[model samples]
Target: MEVVVVTLAYTLTGRDTEIVSQLRTVSDTLQTAPGLTHLRSYRGRQKGGAYALFLCTWDSENSWRKAQEQYSPHKLLQEAHKRQELLVIDPLQWVMHYVWGYTRPLAAPTLAAIHLMSAPPEQEVLLQNGWRRTLQHHVQEPALAYAFLAHSTTPTTDEAHEGPVTVLFCFFSWSSQMERDLFYSEKQIRTMHAFSEQGSSVQILALEPL
Candidate 1:
C-alpha cells in the first residue's frame, strides 16, 4: 500500500476537548493539503488523567515530507508539549507506520492499543516475526475490529540501506475494553506476557478515541 500513517500519542495535562478546540485553526489549514487524506484525534485513560493521539494518513512518505516542510502539525504540537499543555510521557515511543496490510474494521473502534518493541539491528527480524504471530492471537477475539503490522522496511526508501530494521510497531483496535477483557483468560494473559518478554523497550499502551 502507498499509504503512510504517522501517530503522535502524548499525555495531556488537560482533556483533548480543549486541544480539539485549539486545533481548529491548524486543522482547517491542514485539510487543504492534497496528499493528506485524513487527520484524526483520540483520547484514552489509565492511571493518569488522559492521553491523546493524533493520526495522520498521507498518500506517501514523500507527500508527508513535503507537508512537513510547508506546515508541520508535529512541530506545532511539540511546542505546546514543551510548554506542558500536551506533554509526552516518553518522547521516543511515538508510533509511525506504513500500511503494509489493510482491513477495515466492521465496527467503530471504541478502544485501541499499540504494541511497541525494539532491539538491535541484528535482532529486528526476530522481533518483527514474533510480533506478527502475537498479533494473530489478538485478532482472534470477536471484539477485535482490526489489526495491522508495520512493513519491515527501513526509513526513507524500501530499497534498503546499510542498516537493518531495528524497531517495529503493530496496532489493533477493539470494540470496547469490556469485550476485550471477556475474551482473555489467565492462560491468554500469560501468553501475552510471554511475548512481551522477547524484546527490549516493549510497551502495550491502552487507548480510546477522543
Candidate 2:
C-alpha cells in the first residue's frame, strides 16, 4: 500500500520561524526522491506557540522502504545535528509522528480534518472494521469529494489513553463550508459513533494546505 507520513509539531515555544525553515530545508530533497507523489507543509498556531504539519505521500510501502536505503551516515549525522538545534531552540516542544495508509489521494482538496485519539490494543480489529464500514457507506455522498481513513503502524503509544494510540486522519473536501458541516453533521449521527466508540478521547484538527 501507499504510505502517507503525517507529522505534527506543537508547543514549539517561540522558534516557529527557524523550525519551519529548517524543516523545509531538510525536506526539499524528497521532491526528487523516487515514489514521492506529493509533499506539503502547513502552519497554524494555538496557545503554546506555533504548529506545523507535514504530509508526505509515497507510491507504495516498497517504494518508501527502497528510498530509505539511500540515507547515508553523513546524511543521518546532519539530520541528527538539525534535531539537536531544534532541541536547543525549544526544549519543551512535543511532536506526534505516524505513517498511515494512503488509500486515496487528494485532488485539489480545500478543507481537511485530522482525528487524533488513542484506543485499547484489543480494539484494533474493531476500529479497522469501523473504518471499512464507514468508508463503504460514505462513498456515494455527493458533498464529500474525497475521503481517506488511515491508521498508524508499528508505533504504539499510551499518551492519550490506557492502551495503544491510533491516529485516524480524515482529509475531506466540499464545495462550501455549509456542505462540509452538513456532511459531518450527518456522519456524526451515523458512523462517528461506530468508530469513535473504540477510542477514549478525540481531537479534530482543521487544516489548510500551505
lDDT of all predictions: 0.57, 0.55
* Model 2: per-residue Cα lDDT over 69-116, one tens digit each: 552212422463466455323221112223323323353456655666
Best by TM-score: 1
Candidate 1 wrongly placed segments (more than 4 Å): 1-5, 14-17, 23-30, 79-84, 88-105, 134-142, 151-165, 182-193
Per-residue error at 40 for model 2, in Å?
3.6
TM-score of each: 0.70, 0.68
Residue-wise lDDT of candidate 1 within 61-175, one digit each (tens)? Answer: 6787777755466665565556546655543323255533435456767777766555555555666666566555555645466566663345322223344335566666767
Q: Clashing residue pairs, candidate 1?
A: 42-210, 43-210
The local lDDT score (0 to 100) that residue 112 gets in candidate 1 is: 79
What shift in Å separates residue 7 of candidate 2 from its native position after superposition? 1.6
RMSD of each: 5.4, 5.3
